[model samples]
Target: MPNRTDLEALPDIPMDDDGPVFREPWEAQAFAMTLELHQQGRFSWPEWARYLHQEIDKAKQSGDPDLGDTYYQHWLAALENICVDKKITSGEALAERKEAWDRAARSTPHGEPIELDRAIRRGEFDK
Candidate 1:
């Protein structure tokens, strides 16, 4: 997990919305691992931030500008690189997951997995 202080200090990273941006290339790699670990329910936010700060400081001390600026394009590159390196799941895997979800959804009599469309059609929300 990352520290609160370091996380606040780090620049804003825009992936989907507002979040931490990896400052160093290796930092990005760590971020990717952290994300995977998060998905797997390993490290919490505090621990992740602390880890990120430790990594960024290491990059600064090492004097490697490859991590890039506040945006840290290199960081993003590193994340992608590491994600590929780890290869726990591929895009195809996600597609398969989605396909399975769809099948399960169609099996349900509610119409959709979320039931949003069915609810709307039923006018359950109408007042």
Candidate 2:
């Protein structure tokens, strides 16, 4: 829901004539999710920018090249940080959900939609 002016204000983001440029589908999805959250008043653009900059800085400290390819990974990390900071979700809850999704994706047939199985629904991740 971010307009051109809003997107333009964020210098860290790479954009093209059509819009933001993403190397993968998840990158695009993360970008869209952040923009949608802003639109819904979850956070202001400046606040989002601050969190994103922090994530990028952390990655750089860890020897990331700040290359365009890893841009969205930082974006996703920032989004997660804000979600936790705002009390929308906890880190532990997110980890559990990620484990469930990983299990579902692993068992799903190629090209089929992934869904949680009985074990996942029952919070059974041991297997």
Candidate 3:
């Protein structure tokens, strides 16, 4: 995991004195996942930074405005890309999982947490 100095060196992270600030639950989740992956030695900090920069650049090329709101979207993209590149997970698996989550979210009532296991038990993942 990156130290405070390393994290501070990165550009445009929404942070407070308390550390990284997230506007939504999934943003924090993505941030935590990256930290855990790093701690597991899945990739070095430099490698993660490079992938994140690439994702940001790619988003810009596709006309994504340099708005603050999309920051975590880029972060998530970098995570997925790096995971696939490192063979930690395949693109197909990610896509399937994303679909499963979407189905779970749809089935969940408002204000309720979406659970993938429930979706699976409901045979939502049956192909």
Best by lDDT: 3
Model 1's number of clashes is 9
Window of ten residues with lowest summed lDDT in model 2: 118-127
Q: Runs in model 3 with CA error above 4 Å?
A: 109-113, 117-127
How many clashing residue pairs appear in each of the predictions shown? Answer: 9, 0, 0
Q: Sorted by TM-score, highest first, which candidate order results?
A: 2, 3, 1
For residues 4-111, write the lDDT of model 1, one tens digit per residue.
553565444433335554445666675666566656755455554444455555666777663345335334433433344457445554455556557556767875
All models: lDDT?
Answer: 0.50, 0.85, 0.86
Among the numbered candidates, top TM-score falls to: 2
Query: Candidate 2 — which pairs collide?
Result: none
Regions of model 2 farther than 4 Å from truth: 122-127
Query: Candidate 1: worst 10 consecutive residues by lDDT?
Result: 73-82
lDDT of 2 by residue, 1-127 (tens): 7788878777468888988887889998988888888888989998998898899999999999887778888899999999999887889888988988998899898999889887657765442
> Model 1: runs farther than 4 Å from truth?
1-33, 65-127
